[model samples]
Target: MRRVLFAARSAVALHRLLDVVPVFAGDARIARCFTLVPGSDFGVDALAVVDALGGRVVPWEEACAGAYDLVVSASPKGELALLSGPHVLLPHGAGFSKTIRAEGSADSASGLDPVYLRRAPIALHAMAHPDQVARLRAAGTGAASRARVVGDPTLDRLLASRPLRDRYRAALGTGSRRLLVLTSTWGPESLLHRRPDLPAELAAELPYDEYQLALVVHPNEHSRLGAYDLAERLAPAFDAGLVLAAPREEWAAVLVAADALVTDHGSTALYFAGSAADDRPVVGVGSGGPELIPGSPMDELLRSVPVLGRGQEIRRALDAYRPGAARHAAEAAFAFPGRALERLRAELYGLLGLTPAAATSPRLLPSPAPARRMPAAFDVHAGLIPDGVRVARHPVGLAPAGHHLAVEYGAAGEQVTLSAGVLYRRPLPSGAGWTSGGWTRHALDSYPGCRTAGVVQPCGDGVLRFRGRELPYAVRIEARVEADGRVSAVDPAVAVSAAHVWVAGHRDWDGGRVVFNCLVGEREFRVRLREATEGEAGAAV
Candidate 1:
C-alpha cells in the first residue's frame, strides 16, 4: 500500500478539498493527516471527511517521523521543508491567485520548487492553467520536466454540489430573486483604507433596493478602523439594505448562491470565476489590471467582464452586464470533482510502484516523534555598561509623581530638554541660545532638587569647568561622545516639533561608532538604561 501524507495549515481549504477528493480516489484512504487547529468555531468539514475515510489525524509537527511515498501540502510556507517524497502543492486559492509576480523575477514560482521540483524522483502538480504551468517551468528548476496542469480540486466542490439558490436566499432572509454578494478584500497598505473620499464612490453606485447586498468580511481584519472594518462600517450608510457577515466562512453558501458578484483584487474573485464560470455578471471593482487570471488564457473568457475603478462605474457595469440566462453556469465552469485526488494518487503510484487498490487500502504511516525540548539550564552571558558616561538628571517641577525627565538630541545638532519645574519668570531672548533674560525664574524648594552652572576656559577641546569641577567639554561641537564610547549629547536637532521629537545617540548597530537619531517622547521615555561604553561621558561634572 502507498503511504500517503497530507498536510494543510488551514481547516477551510482542507475541508473544501475533502468535499470531493474522496469521490475520485475510490476507496483511497488518508494514511495520515497533519493540521493546525486554532480554537475557532470554524468547522473542519475536510478533517471530518478524512476521519470518515479512515485517515489518521495528527498535529502538524508529527509529519517528519516516517518515510512516505506521497505528500500533499496546502501551506506554501511549509511546502519547501516537507518535500521528502512525491508531493502535490495545493496553495489555498486565496490572494495568491491574483498575486502579480515582480517583473523579470521568478521568486514566487522558484520559491515553490524548493519542496517540489528539486526533490528528485518526485512530481509537481499545479491546480492552475497551462500558462501557469509554463510560467512555473520557465521560472523553476526541473519544473519544465515535472509540472502538470490539473484544475483546482476546491472548484470541483462547487461544480458537483447542487445549486442551493433558494435555500441560501431563505437563510439570508431574502426572497428568491437575484442577489449581489460583495466580498470585501481590504488590504492594510491600500489607499482604500486611508482615503476619505471612498464613501462617496461606493455611495454613488449600488443604491438599488431590489438587488439584495451581502457584505462578506475578510478574516484577517482586526478592527473597525481597519480597511475591512471601515468597509463594513460604511456599508450601512450606502445601503441600509446591506447585511454584514462577520467571522467569514458563513459566506461559503453565499459565494455559491449569489447571482452576481463584486470583489477587490483577491483570490475570492478568482474562486468565483474558476467555479462560477463567466456566466454571472462578475465585476472587478478597484482593479487596474485585466479582469481575468494573469498569464492565463482565461482572460479571453473574462474580456466582457467589467473592471471598475470607481463605485459608480461598478454599479453601471453591474446594471449593464446582467447575466444573460447563464444562471447555472457556475456548476459547469468548475466541474472536476475527485480530479485532485486522482492526480495525487496517479503521481504517488507512479513514483512508489503501487497500484490504486493497494494504495487506497488502510496502512500505517508512522507518526512523527515529539520534539526534544532543550534543558532549562544553559550557559548564559550577561554584561554591564562601563563606568564613564554621566547620566543627566531631570529638573524638578509639580508634575505627576512617576514623571521623569529626559534629554532628546536630534539630527542637525538640536536638543530638547524637558523636565517638570516651577515656571521661572525671566525675560529670556527665546532664540537659539540660552540666556538668563529669556526665562523668569520662580524658585520654590521642591522635593527633587535641580542645579546648573557653566565654567568655560578652552577655545578648542580641552579641560572645561562646570560647578567647580574640571571636565572634557567642547564649544560649538557637532556631537558629544563620553569616555565610555556612549553618546553624551548632540547639538542642533532636525525636524523638531511639538508633536514629534528626534534625538541623536551612539547606536549599537554601527559598530558602536556612529551617531543615529531616534524618536523620543512620552512613549519612549520609559526605557531603562544599562551600563555605558568606552568614550561615553562619565558622571556630569
Candidate 2:
C-alpha cells in the first residue's frame, strides 16, 4: 500500500484537504495518515475538525520523520519541508485571489509567493484556472513549472449540491423568512471587522419573522479568536437571532440556503455567486476589493457587485435588489467546472504512484441545521391601528429601540430591570385569574416595571390574559378570529407586549375586544383579542 500523509496547517487548509480526501475513499491501495502541522495561528479547532471526521491521526513529529509516497497539504504555510516526501499544495480558496503576506515579509500573490513556496517546496501545485497558472508564471515563482490547472473541488462540490437548495433552506428552519448570509475573509478587511456592528444592525433593521440572518466567517478569524471567545464576542448578534455556520462544514450549506448575500472579499461569495445564477442578489460591504489580486475573480466581483453604499441600510438594499454580473464573471475563474473531482483524482493518483481507480460519483451529504439563537427579550415597538395597534419588535440585547420591553420570564440569567414597562409570563391567582385582578397586582408587586403579564392554560391554550390597573376584575381574552394560527399560540413575551401596548392607549379601557396589527417585514398579522369570561379562563396558570 502507498502511504499518503494529509498535512493540515489551518482550519481552512484542513477543509480544502477534506474535499480532496473524499476522492481517494474506497481505494484500499492508499494508506492515509493525518496530522495537524503547528506554527501557525490558524490552529484552533483544527484537530477537532479531524476528530469530528473520524480521521486516523499520526503524531506530527512521527509523521514528519516517517517515509511517505505523497504529502498532501492545502496550505503552503508552516514548516512542511521537514516532512520527507513529494509535497503537493492545494489551493484552499477561490484560486488564490488574495495577495498574501508572510510574517515579516512583503505582500505578494498568494499561491505564487516564492517565499512561502521555498519554505515548503511542493512537487505539485493545483491551480483552479488557467488565469491563476499564468499569474503564477508572471510572479517569477519558479514553482510555476509544477503548477497545473486541475479546477476547484470546492466549487465542484457546490455545483453537485445545488439541486438540494430547498432541502438546505428547510434544514435551516427558515419559515416564511428570507435567509440572508454575510461572509468575510479574516483580517481588518473582513465584513465583520470593517462593520463590527453590522450583524446586530441588520438584525434590528430587518423584521424578526421576515428575515433570517446567518454568518460565514473565515476560519482564520475562527482560529485566532477561538470559538468560545468568538461566540461570546458575537453574543449580541446571537441574541438577535443570528445563525452561525461553523467555520468548515456548514458554510457551504448556509450559502446554498441563503436567499441573499452581504459579503466582503471572501472567496465563498465568489463561489456562491457563480453557482446561484445571480438569482440571489449580493451586497458588497467595505472597500476590500483592492486587497485581492488585480483582475482576479474576486476583485472583478467587488468592482461589479452592488456596493452597500455609505449611509444606505442593507435592509433597503435587499428590499430593492437587482442582479449583478456575478455568475458570468466568477465562472471565468474556474476551468473544467463540474469535472474538478474527476480531473483532480487523476492528478493525485499520479502523484501517489498508483493507477487511477474507476471514477465514482461523489456527493456532499446534506448538512445539519446551523446553530442559532432566538432573542429572549425584545423592545416592542407599537403604533395605533383601528381598534388596537400596529406593532414591531427589535431585540433588546442587540439593538434596543422600542417603546416597551418584553422579556421571556424564567429565561436563563433572568434579571428584571426598570424600563418604561416590561412584559413577562406569570401564573394567575387561583380563583382570581384575570377576574379579581389579583394576578396583575401580584405581578406588579413582584417584577418592577412589569406592566403586562400572561399565562397559557392547558384547555384554552391559544387565548390572551389581560387586565387594567383601575378595573376591579381582569378580563380574560381569546384571540379574535385567529383560532388556529401562529399568533393564537402567541409567545407569552410577545403577547404580553401587545397587552402592554393595549393598556397604554386604553388606560380607561374597560372590558372589550381590541385588535392588533403586527408588521412582520412587509406583511401584517392581525391579532385581535375578544373578552372571555372567568369560566373560560380554564385555570390558566
Candidate 3:
C-alpha cells in the first residue's frame, strides 16, 4: 500500500483523469489520490466523480498536510516547498514556462550547483517533458541523469486506445480526410493574444471551413477575452469551420487524431510533438520563438499550420512531408526520454532510503587510475658539497680531454676566487689567529710544487690573463650543478655543454677533515689538509 499524492495548482480535469487511469493499469498500487484546486468552481462535479470512484477530494491547502510516500506536482517551487516526502516534478510541457521564472533567477544569482555542473547526479529534472529534458541537458546539467523519453503518461492514455479517435470524429461529424486543427485561445497576458494586428494576420493566411479547425479555449482564456471573443466572433473571417470541445480530454484525443495542428507557443505543441510520433502531422504557430522542425510526427503537424504571415516560408518548406527522413528525426527527437526517466528515478530514490542499483560491475564507474610519483632527489651515488668553499672567480678554458673546470683558490677565512690556470697548494695564507709557525706555511706550500704558481685572472673583457698572456674566455660556467655531478657551461655563446667539477676540501676547516678530487696533470688527486691555531695548533706543529 504505497501512498502517492498528485498535486496541481490548477487543471483539475487532467489530474482527475490521471488518478483514475492507474487503477485499470493494475501494476501501480494507489493507496490514495488527491487534487488541489485553488479558486472557486473547484469543479465539484469532478470531485463527485473522484468520490464515486473511491478517492478523496480536498482543498489545496488541506491536502498538503497529510503524509505520503510520493508527492508529484506540476508547480516546481510550490510543490517542492509543500511536499515533505519523495517528490516528482512533472514539468508541464517542454518549452519555457513559469518554472523558468523561479529556477532561472536562482540559477542566475547563485551560479549552477557544482554537483549539477560536474556529475549531474541523475536528479533535479528526471520525469520532465522530453524537450525540457533536452533543454536541461543543454544547460550542462548532465543529460545522462536528468531525463527519459518514457512517453508521458498523460499522452500515453491517448496512445493506449484507438477508439477515442472515432468517437471524437463522430462527435464532430467530420469526414476522415478533414484535417482537425485545434487552436488554443490565447489569454490577454499571452504575448500572441494581445497584439491587435495578429488576428487580422491570422485571418489572411487561414480561411475557415476550407479545412476543419477546432478552436479550444483554455479555461483561463474564457475570462481573459474581455469584449472580443476571438474564436467565436472572428470565426467568419478565418473561414469558420470551427468546432469547440468543452471537455479537455476530448480535445486532446482530437489532437491525437488530427492531421495537423496550429497554435502559439504553449504546452500543447510539446505534448503533441512528444505523443503523436506515429500520427499524421501536427503544426504549431509561434511568434518567432524556438520552432520545432518537421521531423517527428508532431513536428509534422506543427510545421503544417502557418503562423499567419510570419512563418509562411517555413510552412512552404514543410509542404512536402518526407516520411523517409522521420526515422533519424524520431531518434534525435526521442532520445531524451529514457535518460529523463532515469534522472527522475534517481532523484526520487535519493529522497527515499532506496539505493540505486550499483553500476553493472565496478568497471562501469572505475576508480581514478593512480598517478605516477617521481623518485626522491638525493640518491646514493650523489656526493655532498663541503661547507666552506666559496667559488668566487673563474676563467673559461678547455681541459686536457676537452672538458672545462673553474680553478678555485681560497685561504682559511677568505672568499675563494676561481680562475682558469691556477692551482692551490699548501701554506694557505699567513693568518696570525689560525696558523702556528712559519714552518706550517712551508709544509702547506710544499704540498703542490709549482702547480700553485700561475693563478688566472679576468681582464674585464671576456679573456683570462695567466703569466701576462691573454686566453679567450670561450666557456661559461652555470651557477648550479646537476644532480649527476655535472656542471652546465656554454662556449662562445653557441655550444652548450656540462662538465664534471669538484668543490674544495680541507681538514680542521670546520673541525672535520675535508677532501676533494682535483684534476692534477692527466689524473685526479685527492687533497687533504688541517688548519691550526697559535695556542693548541702550535703544539701540533
Best by TM-score: 2
Candidate scoring better on lDDT of 1 and 2: 2
Q: Which ten residues in a row have the lowest lDDT in candidate 3?
A: 372-381
Candidate 1, TM-score vs. the true structure? 0.49
Please tell me which predicted candidate would have the highest lDDT against the true structure: 2
- Candidate 2 residue pairs in clash (backbone atoms < 3 Å): none
**lDDT per prediction?**
0.39, 0.70, 0.37
Error of 1 at 275 (Å): 3.7
lDDT of 1 by residue, 335-446 (tens): 2432654565566456666555643311111111222111111011111122111111111121122222222211111111223211111122343332221111111122
By lDDT: ranked, best first: 2, 1, 3
Query: How many residue pairs clash per model?
Result: 44, 0, 26
On a 0 to 1 TM-score scale, where does candidate 2 land against the true structure?
A: 0.82
Off by over 4 Å in 2: 102-107, 118-123, 142-145, 163-173, 309-312, 319-321, 353-358, 362-371, 386-389, 397-400, 412-451, 455-461, 469-517, 526-528, 531-536, 539-541
Instruction: List candidate 1 segments past 4 Å from native.
Output: 1-3, 10-29, 36-57, 82-84, 94-97, 100-122, 186-209, 217-250, 288-304, 309-314, 322-541
Better of 1 and 3 by lDDT: 1
lDDT of 3 by residue, 405-505 (tens): 22223331121122222332222335324222333233235433211122111211011111221221111222224467643221111111111122111
